[model samples]
Target chain A: EDKVVQSPLSLVVHEGDTVTLNCSYEVTNFRSLLWYKQEKKAPTFLFMLTSSGIEKKSGRLSSILDKKELFSILNITATQTGDSAIYLCAVALGGSEKLVFGKGTKLTVNP
Target chain B: SAVISQKPSRDICQRGTSLTIQCQVDSQVTMMFWYRQQPGQSLTLIATANQGSEATYESGFVIDKFPISRPNLTFSTLTVSNMSPEDSSIYLCSVRQGALTDTQYFGPGTRLTVL
Candidate 1:
């Protein structure tokens, strides 16, 4: 069965601290891996990684994929309270539009 | 990326009642999906709404419980029938623009609280 697993289900960190969230998946014919940040309502798209070893970055947030290991990591540098949200990782399978999502990492950044 | 909107942002419903959530996308999308997210849980795909065809539900989900409608390319609805406290969840609508490689854009989601 195709599944996505995210580690460190919950984390609390002080402002200015950096954090790393992990996601691993096992799927048939993997096509792409995506990261999303969910605040209160919908999850906003963060990054999409299709190739291994290439990092996708947006400001303080960066993510990289590893096809050989079937895992990915998202790193946030100098986090702030505004960065507190649930980080979700999803994988899309080839020939299918469905996205298998991980349980998500709830990061709470305190000032 | 597509812009999606959902109606009834939050609702308090009594048990035994039903709630229908609406999803609308700015552009015509190729695929639409309904998902359920319980408190502090991951998103689970409920069904795939196909335009001009019946919705395809996932394992452990049935059409009679979560009926879905996709009348067009950019509009769809999901109805939670015979609700219970266990059904209290965030119902999200997601859309894929062109192909399987396209990222799915999600709506704001309808927060349903069953009491």
Candidate 2:
């Protein structure tokens, strides 16, 4: 069975603090890992990682994948209240478009 | 990425009733996906609707319960039949660049509350 697990189901932090969200998976025929941020309803695309070591960054948000360890991390530096949302991690099944998702980490950045 | 939209942003439905959620895309797409998000839970794929074919439902989801229709390239609809309290959830529709693409753009989602 394919499974995706995310750590720290919920977190509370102050503005200007940095936070790291974790995601690990167990699945056959690995394909790719993706991150999304859901503020209210729809989740917005964040980063998609397929190779190890290589990192993808956008502004203060960055993510990296470790295929060997079957895990990935999303880092948000200089966090602001606008960054408060539910961060979701999903892994796509190889040779298929199906994605297994984790429960997500809810981050609340207090002003 | 495509501009996706869903109708009835929020609704309160009574038990034993039914609701049909419509999904529309700004551009033509070969495939459209329907997902369900339970309260405080992750998203789950309910079915994959392809034009000119029957919708392929995932495990634990049946066509009789969640009927889907793909009439054209840019439009699809999912109907929740015989609604129950457990059927209350947020239904979202998504579309990717291609059939093999993994990145998907989502709709705002229809929040259904069954009472």
Candidate 3:
């Protein structure tokens, strides 16, 4: 079975602090790694990392994949209350339409 | 990316009563996936809904318990049969625009609380 594991299940940080969330996976055929942020019901896309060492960023959030290490990390800088949410990491297997997901990291950013 | 919508954003149902959740995408998608999220837990994929064929269920999931129908490319439905308190969960629908490596967009989700 394909599995994705995330570190630091939950974290609380003050405003302006930086946080890093980690994700590691074990799959048969690797395709891509995806990040998402869930505030309420739906999960909004954050980034998709396919190659190693190449970073994907959006505003205060950035992510990178290390295929050799079989892991990925998401970094949030200058955090704000609005950044409080569950961050999810998912890996897509080659030749499959399903996504294997990590348990996620619940981030609480206090102002 | 696609705009996805789910019906009955939330509901409280009695044990043994079944519920059918609907998912609609703004555009035609080749692949639609169903997932379940229990309280304080991550999402678990249930099945992949094909546009003109039967839904492909994952391990530990069965057609009798979670039947799915994809009448067209833009719409699908998932029915939770013989429900119990254990079946209470947040059900979500997602779509992949192009290849399997493409980003998946999720619906608002149906929150079902079985009592």
Candidate 4:
């Protein structure tokens, strides 16, 4: 069975703090790893990492994957209160387009 | 990116009742996905709905309990039958477009509360 595990189910941090979220997975075939920020009912796309060692960035947020170790990390720099939300990690199955998701990391940013 | 919409953003239904949630995409899509997120839980795939074939359900999900309809490329519906309090959850609709690695976009979701 394919599974995705995320660390620090919940985190509390003050504004301007930097935090790192982790995701490790085990699947039959590796395809792609995706990160999403879900503030409410819908999850917005953040990054899709398909290669190892390369980093994908968007403003204050950045992510990188290590395929050999089968894990990924999402880093937020100078985090703001607005960045407080559930960060989800998902892996796309090799043969199928199906996505297996992690329990998610709930980051709480306080001003 | 696709603009997706879901009907009846939230509903309170009586036990044993049924409710059908609608999902509409701005553009035609090849595959649509239905998911359920239980309270405090991550999203779980309920099924994959295709335009010209029967919907494929994931493990722990069956067609009879959660029937799906894909009448066209731009629309689909998921019906929750014989609801119970345990069935209360947020049902989300999603679509994948563009290249093979394209991320799936989700609808606002329907929040169901069974009493």
Candidate 3 chain B — worst ten consecutive residues by lDDT sum?
A: B95-104
**Model 3 / residue B50 / CA error / Å:** 0.8
Model 2 lDDT tens row, A6-100: 99999999999999999999999889999999988999999989999999999999999999999999999999999999999999998766878
Q: How high is the lDDT of residue A40 in model 3? A: 89
Q: What ranges in model 2 sit over 4 Å off?
A: none
How much does candidate 2 score in TM-score?
0.98
For B1-115, candidate 2 gives per-residue lDDT tens digits of: 8899999899999999999999999999877999999999999999998797899999999999999999999999999999999998999998877755688888999999999
In model 4, where do residues sit more than 4 Å from their true spots?
Answer: none
For B17-108, candidate 1 gives per-residue lDDT tens digits of 99999999999989999999998789999999999999999999999899999999989999999999999999999988776355888999
lDDT of 3 by residue, B48-88 (tens): 99888899999999999999999999999999998999988
What lDDT does candidate 2 reach at residue A26? 97
**Candidate 1 residue A92 C-alpha distance from true site, Å:** 0.7
Off by over 4 Å in 3: none
Give the per-residue lDDT of model 3 (tens digit) for A7-106.
9999999999999999999999999999999998789999999999999989999999999999999999999999999999999888878789999999
Whose DockQ is greatest here? 3
Arrange candidates by DockQ, highest first: which order?
3, 2, 1, 4
DockQ of 4: 0.78
Candidate lDDT (C-alpha), each: 0.94, 0.93, 0.94, 0.94
> Which regions of candidate 1 fall more than 4 Å away from where they truly are?
none
Task: Give a tens-digit lDDT track for model 4, residues B74-108.
Answer: 99999999999999999999999854664888899
What's model 4's lDDT at A48?
92
